[model samples]
Target: MTQVATTDRALPFDVEAVRADFPVLDQQIHGKPLVYLDSAASAQRPVAVLDAMDRYYRNNHANVHRGVHTLSQRATDDYEGARQRIAQYINARSACEIIFTRGTTEAINLVANSYARPQLGNTSEIVITQLEHHSNIVPWQLVAAQTGASIRVLPINDRGELEIDQFEGLLNDRTCIVAVNHISNALGTINPVNDIVRIAHQHGVPVLLDGAQAMPHTAVDVQALDCDFFAFSGHKVFGPTGIGVLYGKENLLEQMPPWQGGGEMILSVTFENSTYAGLPHKFEAGTPAIAEAVGLGAAIDYIVALDIERIAAYEQQLLDYATERLATIDGIRFIGTAREKASVVSFTLEGIHPHDIGTIVDSEGVAIRTGHHCAMPVMDFFGVPATARASLAFYNNRDDIDRLVDALHKTKQVFG
Candidate 1:
């Protein structure tokens, strides 16, 4: 770990040293120094993650699990090594519980098709919260349509937080699964997942958490949360894209059938008899994302070195600073005001479209996310078409927030 000079900053961690690790942040955007604030969508990667992927492709690029040569063995080791690191990162019981997919969307869809679909009957119900991203919601909807099952949505309060009481009432004997986001990508509301899991367990329901937005900011212990299944994306964790993880309990994975049937997932194949492989591989079909997995492992290493607890505390400070600064602007209404949140600030500027805000900000070399943020239902609940979202990460500093506020003022000026 590279150690830099310790300064008298609000955070104990060295933000300057951390920012130095991200090479992309060094460049200018639109002839101005870039201030990236859209980490919830996808975070910028560190040099370590980039180097790991490059090393894998250059030295250990080969198909895994069926290798006879030296390259094959190395590739298999690196790939499975990534899985082990991921398992440890999330505190999974074993590496066999970590199934790789394209991203979180595919992970949720796998559970929807294999686990939920088989158990669901005509009268069965799948319960999900309004805070879920489209990835979590659409899959269950598709499975429900196929199996003649019904979908039930747990409501959220005006503050954009999940209604725990409503969620408890929605779970019944007929409920097949309870799916929700660990943190809202659009709102930054941290759901009470521990309570969710405990309540669902009482009704004999399994809970699946979409941890895509949560992985980058906070520490997640699957064992501690006691969720039946958890899904997260690699790209959001400062890793390369196209690789993600789906963790399932040992017993549940053994019973669930494979969602896709292709190369790596099967043990023995025949015209009449095709037996599937065990736990993790049973779900991971076709050629896996080898280089991306190595990058994800490197990303995990970076986070472990930094210490997630410290990162979370520092980011909360950033969120607070940004919120306080942005609040001074007139006609600025915050979208999510949950007592508990991560490093996301979403709001609407009166008499201005979010798209225009995003466009104007980009000109000033300040990046922000604009739109319904793939949670259109949240937009409907707030009665707004879209919002301007500035999400932070460990790398972001006070300067980034200042630039964003200045850019918003410019947007207001232009719109007027």
Candidate 2:
């Protein structure tokens, strides 16, 4: 991997200019410059995103798709405009296929409840991987319990890469769905989702990719991947919290029953029977997060203004530099070493609990995630309770990695 030079023109976007756009990054923690490296959990929003939401609430805040007033019309346009932008961001076929939800967790649960529950039978099996977050795991379990279906898990190796052969073996006639993460939140292992989708589709099974971690770092084309469903959180992509997207193939989405019933999701409500709405509106219940959706559009615009390839290249360099630095530290054991990985590093120190390590790092103004990260199965596979994770983004630079390494050394010295 090539190291990014401090004077590289490849990064057309100025780091200082970008940093200035994020107000939160200017703060001090423990009397030192804050080093935030948990983008996988949530990304810091730019001024554009914050301004978009503020602008919406200030001027165009109104209920969508209902009122005939001008404010309602503007709000509806902005809200639907955000959907269109998201559709283009992920290269989905149509805006009708995109349904906004709370986040990735709710998106998966929507699929499990609406599609999997209706289609899967008593003997049907839902195959997922150990790399999945609990959001991806528990929903299928609930669906299985309700439908008399079973849940099968694909295992991983010590390096935290998925066992592809085992995954292939598990795809049989009885498999109804395959729910996997595009990138592991805990390990940063970028799974071969295209292959997983192809294999599952061969058995006439649909695949749902949890793309929370993958969307921020790479470009995703739902059409090219040909997965039945893809889901991600807006907060994970430099957008607002409490807003996410669920993208399904048009046919698949049309076939799935509406998961929730309320005002916007309904066409006609009688005392006896109620008729549901169509496509995206069918899945979106009650009043949607209008301002947040508008802010997500602005976030997408901010990302679009930057060259994605350049951003990804810069992030890869950061990952490599961080990995090399961590490797040189004694007693620092990295949990994930997949051939293809992302901008996340999960590790543990020999003599320190992950929480203790996190506390020490906090003292140095370095922020990292320390826990199972909602992927306990991966922890079980690795034979550890939890590992400290430093998930990076394009805005992060080499200086952040230096701070992380220095903090890790201090953690070891204090604990050892």
Best by TM-score: 1
Question: What are the lDDT figures for the candidates, one per model?
Answer: 0.92, 0.90
- Give the worst 10-residue stretch by lDDT in candidate 1: 1-10
TM-score for all models, in order of appearance: 0.97, 0.96
Which ten residues in a row are the worst by lDDT in model 2?
1-10
Clashing residue pairs found in predicted model 1: none
Off by over 4 Å in 1: 1-11
Candidate 1: residue 323 Cα off by (Å): 0.5
Candidate 1, 121-146: lDDT as tens digits: 89999999888799999999899998
Predicted structure 2: lDDT: 0.90
RMSD of each: 1.9, 3.4
Q: Which runs of model 2 end up more than 4 angstroms from their true locations? A: 1-13
Clashes of each: 0, 0
